[model samples]
Target: MNVKGKTILITGGASGIGLEAAKQFLEIGAKVIITGRNQAKLDVVKKSFPSITAIQSDAGKEEDAQSLFNKVNDLGGIDILYHNAGVGVPPLNLGVPNNNHLKGAIYEMEVNYFGVIRLNNLFMDMLKSRDEAAIIHTTSILSIVPSAIEATYSSSKTALAFYVQSLRKHLQIINSKLKIFELLPPLVDTDMVADRDDKKISPAQLISGLIIGLENDKYTIRIGDSKVIYLLNRLLPKVALNLINPNKYNEKLIN
Candidate 1:
């Protein structure tokens, strides 16, 4: 899993964790292709990193995934598919609990969960035929724990966490070399988080975890704050659940 000389495709690469990953991969000398929904943001990112390949595609859509595969295959085959694009930002501390804004919840699940699945379903084949194929997903602490403000987002990742668990077991029987890794990142200091130090883990640290996951060839990988969740979920599922479920811990958040 030497990152150098590998061909890679990253979804949601215009900004945040995806863009940071693209930069890190470029520094390590990998052939990088980045996809984003926003043309302007993609253009800006492309300008910043002249060597990177920037394509416009919404990673959440099935058609977008298909088009991305076609375009990447045309340029060159892919070795690593990084599904990192996601969205989950709404007002927390609303002074009410179970504050389920139906729209916000839907957006969280659609963008964070289904979006990654769509791309993975499409790109799995392209990577499978190649040597040293791998898929890296960006999950969060909420995936395994709770967040007062990120209820839907956490739930989406939790579902994803389980989905990958099954997917990994199936892939193991078919192809042992195909690696699956999840980054349980802390609150990252990206646009995704505007008011917290928990997102303190740098993109570099996350990329380092990616490399470690590849080198070890481990079936499951967890890094940063999500590591806390993984441990807590195992030894203290109740504790972890209480911390992440907003309505449970925050009285004001309960309706």
Candidate 2:
């Protein structure tokens, strides 16, 4: 769980939470390598943080995942793989018969859920070979309670949350020393949600909490409203559902 002196590869590191995490991890003495689809953004990150190794790669592409693994292997491999790349299609009226519904769902699944699996499969052996290694999954609070407005996004994160748990148990059964950590973050102040009026925690706050969790070996790291929603969902599912999908969102969904 010690991050110092470890090499961590983070996906979608050009901006938002991933960029913040890269900065914090670098400050803590971890060698940070970040991947993003945009080469220009990667260049900007590389220029700003000369210590970070920025790579242009798309997380959702299988070919890109294999290429990234090869590139990282040539750079001496990584001790941690952080799955932070996720995409959410614009809100669609699923209740109405529309072609875009399935398309949006598939796109979300491809980037947010399947992308993690692809990278994990590519890096599993490399991670297992390390003396101390870990995999971090950035799932969302919506994984606990579905958001009517962002249904596909919620489903994608929920799928990933389940997979992370199962993967952790599987690794444990095999007596693997590699640690699996699931980070459940509430609404974050990032480009992805810039249009939303909902309250959000700064990326710095979220990543700071994540660092503390990593240092202490906390497998399930829930920050901000994520903690509250998780507890409420466990005790009062209806209340938790209402909290996530308020009247305004419900009205939007109906119309």
Candidate 3:
């Protein structure tokens, strides 16, 4: 899709991938409005990118979703619904059960999975009404190749991937102009994974791949090592599992 002159709404736009994408979209001449839960962060982003619109809204809350829809609806609808809001699951500590971790897992589901669904249901009709529109979900390679340390996170993305897959079929059945795109990105150098020294791609690389994918109409855009990870998981599940979660199933732990 042409980024120029499009009305784009991105959730969790305060930082990381969403923030970077919002900046790039603005540079492409799109009317971008970004939503985040932190008003202070939103204000900071707004100041930095005066041309972009920033709003404070929690993607995990139904009322906030409604408010977001109302606001966007007032702006004459959005051309792209970018579901970028999600949280990482806390690192799992083996051989010990932590109640707080369990609670964090549940919260992760609410934000990563349920919130996307709720916002999509609310904004889907608007997108369908547009002549050219797309819904982009920022999932992860973990959806295809699970990591035991990120159990809930993997499950949530897997569920979202399933939903987006099915939604594509339904859209085709109705002959709708709406396009469903899933962005599966590998570990990137973002605030979300700042501490990690894993082989990570830059945000610029991620957005560059995204634009190329969109221009070519790649429905499922796999960025960085995600494509490799996906194929390995499909063709050699055990090897893929061992590579992604070595700590969880180390030789010592398994033996």
* TM-score, per-candidate, Cα-based: 0.87, 0.98, 0.94
For candidate 1, lDDT tens digit of each residue in 1-255?
A: 777888888888888788878888888888888988899998998888888899899866777778887888788778988878888856455444544567777777887888888878877787788778888877777776667666667788888888888878889888567778776776677766665444377777877786677677765667776677678889989887765563444543443
Ranking 2 against 3 by lDDT, winner: 2
Best by lDDT: 2
Which residues of candidate 3, in runs, are more than 4 Å off? 247-255
lDDT of 2 by residue, 98-217 (tens): 899899999899999999999999899999999999999999999999998889999999999999999999999999999999999999999988988998999999999999999999
> Over 4 Å off in model 1, which ranges?
92-100, 197-199, 237-255
lDDT of each: 0.77, 0.94, 0.87
> Scored by Cα lDDT, where does model 1 land?
0.77
- C-alpha lDDT of residue 35 in model 1: 89
Tens-place lDDT digits, model 3, residues 1-255:
777899999999889889989988887888999999999999999889898888789988989999989988987889998998899865665446668677877788899889999999999888898888999998898998887767778888999999999999998999998989999999889887787667899888998898788878899999978988889988998988877876634533334
Q: Provide the lowest-lDDT 10-residue window in model 1.
A: 246-255
Choose 1 or 3, whichever is better by TM-score: 3
